[model samples]
Target: MDRRTLWSNGAVAHISLQDEVTAERFTDGEVRRVTYPPLASLCKSPMGNRDREILWGQSFNVLETDKGWAFGYALRDGYAGYIEAQMLAPVEAQATHRITVRQTMALSVPDLKATKAEHVALSLGSEVCVTDTDDKWATVMGAPHTLYIPASHLTPLNDKEADPVAVAERLLGTPYVWGGNSAFGIDCSGLVQIACHACGIACPGDSDQQMAQLGETLDPGTPLQRGDLLFWKGHVGWVSDPDTLLHANAHSMSVVHEPLQAAIQRIAAQGDPVLRYARLTRL
Candidate 1:
């Protein structure tokens, strides 16, 4: 079959099997084939964070049938497991374009003549996919990343455009909440994890998980820029520029951009020096 990209970032579908099959699932692992990419935080079960998570790079081989794709998937870190076909989504890749602004600006519905009517509150340099552009808002198919602008602020990259830097900015001002992954709330590590996910990159859920996955660390004095994943022992965040970090800090209660020096000092006061033993994940 010809290869294609699936746009359903977090959508799910079911498969019907003609014969019973084995499920060799693993957690923190990946699928064997690239037939389709699973959405971030996608769960096979509707239960609370307990469903079989089809992490990035993971796949399940099924018997080709006249009806549709059918088979079980190996989930839970490639551990011993098997789930029904009724829990997955049938997806294929579609073309997408990523856009970055020439200057610091906000995203809004293109239809609105003024900012107040259409402002979507996106951060400057934020990365967004343009599925279709009208006069104002750009329609991003998969996860609703439609950003509105004056049609003059954006510079559209081709389909398959991936900008991790602009992706980091979209999470600004998200509140600091434990286990919260959506824009409504997020933690330092959660911020980095989700940003990577949006950019079609795989990252673990916690700081330690992320640290273990990505090898080595970068020198802080080297200057962290946009899309650089910043780590500090138990916490992680993304850098929007050389001097500012985007993250959800306890003090702020939401995602915010802070000077590197100030963030270091603040975390250090908590006995967790932000720079003392920090790591960097470059995607």
Candidate 2:
């Protein structure tokens, strides 16, 4: 699992391949399969940083072809466009992997010498690719030594064993940053977005996006449940139970759990009374 920053930007996002040789194209929607691994590199174009300037994630599906390799990818968050033959890699997806946070976690390598390297530096909301966990440390790719993080610090965003509440608590004081998905920075929407993802639900990335995904809109007076999804205009949070909701607020840098009534009052005081109401989505 060699990690490459999606762009030269400081933001480090993690993506894994489905098979040994898949193309990671410049444009998102291209699909191609290769017999070898891609050169561990970032997606760069001959044009001067044009594509790199934008913030987006592309989903590409691998397709095997008679030619040496080919790729088909959907760019711009799976909605608008597709491209082909951008880049290729030689490895496949692993059934197991650990995400990392610490600057240097140790990992055992194919070379047999234990190596210590910078694990992916996702603040809080960012994710990493871990191959396995050895005792107290997580074994990530490209490093020779196993990296250590509080077992409590990592979540199985893709695992059935993950504890959503425990994971959500790690960011108690994290500041609310728009479009932030890492602990170093996070947004109200990203807080609930990732929490829901950890629990095996596919939530849209923002408040308005999330509102559309809920099966139905409930009146604010309705009872809530633990793990219920709640939304406010331009903001969103998670319900820990009928009475408590958790969210990252501009007013509160870290995620906070408060009585639902208090939270609604707080929002109403801000002059955005519509932000006081939440539509609930039960998972």
Candidate 3:
């Protein structure tokens, strides 16, 4: 089993894995929601390297808790990791809206001009429960009090962007962060996941998993097109056009649009040539 998705930690595992794996204990995990915003790092081990990130209002199934860390898998992508236990809370309400922009401020009051208004930056894909709404602001139940966000920045949970590439383009210039999943910082796979999720397409969290599970592979020599996925050994990028590639790359340390041929040549020179060319079934 893939350790990233498996709910086992030698001592215990989720009850769902009882039939397939051996463990000293198994129990049905409790569900929780991420209460922190901007983004929450999901670490590979307690205080270890971040394997991925979870946005506000996203669900995490907690199978174990140790010290101050919660060990579980994210419901959005089944990526398992450790998260700060205090950053999560019981699911009090279902998310009604998802942030549509790259980032937006959630103010302490409904008016944007309030001088002392406290604010929190919410990133794209963060979800919230809209309890009240006026023409300009939306009231959401925040940790300590109700917060107001711009009505124009949110969309109903069921709504989705029409173009994944267009969604990806909005995050151009985000700093490259290992295992990051927000507009503030992101990795290549994170960029693809955020864009695909915005378009209502389910996607895996890592590049290899994304390569194995997403889109059908194109035959060798297939011409690249808009929305096509190009995979290198450990990296991936979206083809914005026949000649342009969009990705969050370590070489640039940010998400950027660059000449596709130039990227291919540059990456190949580093010994990681293009591994796969794929086209999504839906777009």
Candidate 4:
């Protein structure tokens, strides 16, 4: 669920995490809106583990502040973390559309030739609203200005794909990251989190938390099937089929398709033994 390239200096970094910032530092009320498109990752600490993702139009409740960093809980999942104050808008904007594709760029203009750092890639399930549109491009309301994304990349929020594993499969070659949850980079739990979110299923932002909260555990002897989840001490993978596993992992440094038993043996050799397998509570 997480990221930004900003943090301020020693004026606040010198202060202890135990102390609170002056209440005056907070914007009115405590609620802030995300202005950064693509994704705003909520981290474990400032520049810490990117545990969850918030799209361009999501909101968060500010609990405290430290210089340019705001500590808060995401309104979407109530997961708490520090986000760069610059990444959020003091004013709120409602989201009406959701990005349904694996990756789509938000362009300053509708033209493909105008691509630059200004147009970063937005990941699946990130929400935005269409303010205006022509036949080929839809204008998405962005932080400082309205940006255009291809009309093909979005769907009305009410229209969602039904298969979670199929959505995960779309990210087959994304690079593995320790805590990233965007198409720009991702982690083991982040992969499942985005996959479940696309199908309108609520999922937690971490592996162990997902294991505890998501679904019913299967008996040790139960047969593996597509959509079954396998877990280790701090990692997870999805069953692509009865015999194959799909996951974003450091071992491959990317999402990969591998034999289920081979993965179990490989991880066991690395000292993290397979802990369990489970299924969606609805499945």
Clash counts for the predictions, in order = 33, 47, 0, 5
Ranking by lDDT: 3, 4, 1, 2
Per-residue alpha-carbon lDDT of candidate 4 for residues 1-283, written as tens digits (9 for 90 to 100): 1212112122232122224432323332267887776667787687776666676667776666767778776765557678887888765457788887888888887788864536857887777879888889999878777788899888887776777899898888999987777777888998998888777778877898888778788998899888999999999999999989999999899988999899999999999888878898654
Per-residue lDDT tens digits of candidate 3, residues 186-267? 9999999999999989999999999998998999988878999999888999999999999999999999999999999999
- Worst 10-residue lDDT window for candidate 4 reads 1-10
Give lDDT tens digits, candidate 1, residues 54-114.
3322344322211233323333122122323333333343323323332223344445546
lDDT on C-alpha atoms for all candidate structures: 0.46, 0.45, 0.92, 0.77
Whose TM-score is greatest here?
A: 3
| Candidate 2 per-residue lDDT over residues 169-203, each given as its tens digit | 66777766655554655677667655555555565
**Residue 92 in candidate 2 has what lDDT?**
45
Off by over 4 Å in 4: 1-29, 47-53, 113-118
At residue 29, candidate 2 shows an lDDT of: 26
Candidate 4 CA-lDDT value:
0.77
Sorted by TM-score (best first), the order is 3, 4, 2, 1
TM-score of every model?
0.48, 0.56, 0.98, 0.84
Off by over 4 Å in 1: 1-161, 275-283
- Best-performing candidate as measured by lDDT: 3
- Cα displacement (Å) at residue 44, model 2: 17
